[model samples]
Target: MDLAIVILNWNGKSWLEKFLPNVIEHSDESVIYVIDNASTDDSISFIETNFPNVSIVQNKTNFGFAGGYNEGLKNIQHEFYCLLNSDVEVTENWITPVAILFKHDSNIAAIQPKILDYNKKTHFEFAGAGGGLIDNLGFPYCRGRVFENIEKDNGQYNDETEIFWASGCCFFVRSKDFWTQNGFDARFFAHQEEIDLCWRLKNSNKKIFYTGKSTVYHVGGGTLNKQSPQKTFLNIRNNFSMILKNSPISTLLWLLPFRLVLDAFAGIYFGYQNGISHFWAVIRAHFSFYKQIPETIKLRQKSQISKFYQEKWLVFKNFL
Candidate 1:
């Protein structure tokens, strides 16, 4: 098969049972594979017995999202790969538009479909609404989502266009380009790794795109609850590492410190809204980022782009 639809699963038997059929029915032409991150539950057995057609790549231990996919995908060879989330419900003809887009341009390395919320259906999903974009300070947001504000689907983002990154929830990418970037930064473990990979791809002159023609509904926070302090920590820490690895040195000098100040304020807000745990998460994230700086700097490519953001001071523009 030219396309491999790979789902990374870690003790998500319920999600697989709920959404796998929809995926199989709509994606007939593509091969389906479940990369099990050493799930302890009966997930592997259930897939083996009920969905014998679906292939399974079992890892010895849970490597989280980034490393799990990186290890799992090394065995599955195809022209293209769709790194789908287990909780997403894909619609009919979802793969065709992305395939057509990829064929139209060899430089187009990645593409994301319109991701809607599974519960509301009318609103764009939080994970990746319309498409992903970054600010001057390397804060990632979607066209339909800015901070806590989510815009309802009004056909405003129903056109195909270039995007800064594709959602990892339903990411489509050329296999060659994926491997060329050496897959995702396993150091990320999870959260914002897709954006980091897309940034690296952009630095190498590859395009990231989005098509509203295809659609998928995501049940956000399937594995990690949105309120989890761990999620906050991963998001903040991974984002810092991503920016440091991809941003031009000249921009990093000022942008990094400015972001740190903004995050301090954000941490206080999160503490008031969520809990003291979130405030501590932001602190932990910064310390982790500091510790990872040597490793992150070593991973930097030969070139870094200056004009990577779609907007300047998006936080101020959105909230102020």
Candidate 2:
């Protein structure tokens, strides 16, 4: 098959029941696989019983998003791999545009479809709006989202464009290119690993694109709630590691510290607005990042290449 749609599942049987039909309906020409991350629930049985034609790859243990997909992808070999989230309801004919993009340009390594909120259909989703973009200091934003601000889908980003990264929510990556970067960082466990992978691809002069021709409705925060402290911790810690693992040492010298300061302000703001647990989650995330610095820097030394950051100071210009 030209494309394989792989959804990573971790006790998300309800999501599968709700959204898998959309994926199967839209991707009749492509193979579909549910890669289970050792769910204690009956997710595997549900898939086997309900969608017998769909393939399954069961992990021995829960590996979170990064390790789970890394392990699951080893079993399938296709020209393109769509790492779709279980909670995403793909629109009709969603996969064709991305496949055409890959076929048209060999250099385009990855692409994301236009993502709108499933609950709030008129607005862009937070995970990936039009496409993923980053600031000079390695902070990520999107064409339709910056911080907590999600833009209304007024066809503002309808044009297909080259992007810095594609959301893991329903991201499409060339299978060979994915293996070239060694897949997602297993150490990331979950969160921000897609950015790191895209950064590596970008460093090697590979293009990532956002195509509005295809669209998907994402029920964001399915596994982890938006306000969950654990989610906050993972996002904060993993983002720091992503910057360190992919950025130049020269940039990291000042940029890392500046990010820390900015993140500190973020922690304070979260504390002011929410509560101490949210603030402490940020503190805990920084500590976790500090502890992993030596190992993450090693990853940086190995993967750091010349190309990075097409845009700069996006946080200040757009959000701040």
Highest-scoring model, lDDT: 1
Which prediction has the highest TM-score against the true structure? 1
Candidate 2 C-alpha lDDT tens digits along 107-191: 9999999999999999999999999999997879999999889999999999999999999999999999999989999988988
- Can you list the residue pairs that collide in candidate 2? 136-313
Model 2, runs deviating above 4 Å: 301-320
lDDT (CA) for every model shown? 0.93, 0.90
Q: How many clashes does the backbone of model 2 have?
A: 1
* Candidate 1 per-residue C-alpha lDDT over 1-320 given as tens digits, one digit per residue, 9 for 90 to 100: 39999999999999999999999999977999999999999999999999999999999889999999999999998999999999999998999899889989999999999999999999999999999999887989999999889999999998999999999999999999999999999999999999999999998999999999999999999999999999999999998899889988778889988888899899999999999999999999999999999999889877653243323446557878
